[model samples]
Target: MATTHHTNETPTDVASNGTAPTSTVSPETLLDYYRQMVEVRLFEEAATRGFRQGKVGGYLHVYIGQEALARGFLDAFRKGDKTITAYRDHAHVLFQGGDPKATMAELYGKGTGLVKGKGGSMHLFDVENGMWGGYGIVGAHIPLGVGMAYSEAYRETGNIIQLYLGDGAIHNGYFHESANLAGLWGKDGMCPCLFIIENNQYGMGTSVERATANTNLGSKFDSYAIPWEKVDAMDLEAVIAVAHKAVDYVRETGKPYAVEAMTYRLGPHGAADFLEQYRSKDEVREARKRDPIGLLEQRLLDLGVTDEEAMEKIRAHAKELADEAVKFAEESPEPDLSELTTDVYAPETGLI
Candidate 1:
């Protein structure tokens, strides 16, 4: 795939496959991003502990190192925008204004969870927040997201859909199908969708180089003629800057766009992935130096946006919030067995 490089332009002026120059973002905004990352990190850490204690059932995937990707891109979302992603979605839900207690409760298999304890770790859905839901199957949600983009275009809603998937998902046939349709529909300037690829280096144990012939994931969109870009997910500002450009391109052109966020997951693929035979501990340790949360915190401090005391206070608050969520999850009640068949279908009376 051919890559395009753009220079001497502001973030808003830049096109796809190019880095955008960071502008004067407000201190409060930067701090809020830092706080969100901290909260997610704390929540994931608590979730790890919860899994260890057997409080959470099913598989556990924590977004320890990829907080910036969610925080930065989600911040670019506008009203009526819809989002969908694969199973590694707790962080996405939380960043989309999901209740921490409800999220944790869902993991605990309680009724108070986002999906009433049924979805568990993978299928978190909060329609009110425009988070369509997370899919357990690899690449399954790609078509669903494209459908959403079609609906928005058909209804003339002027709303875009932000679809997220991992590096591994790009290999699925459904992803290609959706991308091809998005490119086709976008020809009329109506399929506004931002396909975000969270390239965390490894797709559950298999590295990108080992799985695909082309390691440049963004270039995959080139086959569909969709404009693509890549950004350093470790840098919060860079993510935000590039994300704004991507989102704007979709909104302005009423077309599809792609952004490949170069990042790494500090933890194993899942809680049960203890063997970790594919990668070494030293690789993870070295990657920790570029930790998104830590990088944002240091940026905040260096910019005089906040001091160590303030950061410590934020950390404590985040930890307290996570602890409170755990307590709420523990006290929450489980769904009754009767509910199993209730929401499975529409009312017998049919639509009103």
Candidate 2:
């Protein structure tokens, strides 16, 4: 997949993927929601800086503009709730309460990383946060999330699993298989999972319109009789509200729900892919007009958050934390090669 990179743009364009529009939320909620978005943005910027300075290694995907949707879902997630996603998973890790330093160290392939540096930028895990490691294979992790939901239900834990997939995964065979199973189990009150589609308008630079025969990704869940809706990814408050509702619905009904978040990537799939031919700079600039962080920031200001100094302090603090994460990663030790032979098999390994 071709990737594109662009400079940050102000006043990003905001759009909704749903058929019906949602009502407005309070300003106080908006401010808190924006805070989450800002944290994600600052963290990504710091990660990018780390990558350029060689403090971080491997393929890096920065979730700068799409922070609102991810953070919103995190805010809605309950304790012991689970989350899973693909290679583009840094933001998801942070939202799941994984230590930022550990994640940075993982990117640098340091043993202090979340997965003991065994998994680089693509694989982040913090089981305590109910977050499984990011899977490299497209759509492969969907079944894991579904199975987790099944187990949670069987154990009567009342926990919900949030399964995230990129626009590209929707076309994969695993996607259909997982969704069908999720729907079947959900109908019988055996599944407690939320299927979240982070449709950033591109599947590795291929516009959703160009690649999808059924561009209405949210409605596709109807075939399985699973309830679903689309949310405006650019608005943090909107996302939080929608996510809260969805989470509540799934928890109460013990069913699976799908939410399509309409957003833009605003960066290449990774640092290596120079996105040029796929999307124009002007198009990126237009999308930037609806940048989620900026939108939420303005909403906070409108909500009587007159403390400019405090806001600056928050941003600065986030940047400092990111810097510390980079330092930790740089100083952390690498994984020993000898340990690779260990943890290779479970107690009941069918084969030696």
Best by TM-score: 1
Name model 2 segments beyond 4 Å from true: 1-33, 347-352
lDDT of 2 at 349: 82
lDDT of 2 at 114: 85
For model 2 the TM-score comes to 0.88
Alpha-carbon error at 342 in model 1, in Å?
1.3
Clashes of each: 1, 9
Model 2 lDDT per residue over 180-221, tens place: 999999888899999999998878767888887899998878
Error of 1 at 270 (Å): 0.9
CA lDDT, every model vs. true structure: 0.86, 0.78
Worst 10 residues of 2 by lDDT: 1-10
Supply candidate 1's per-residue lDDT for 281: 86
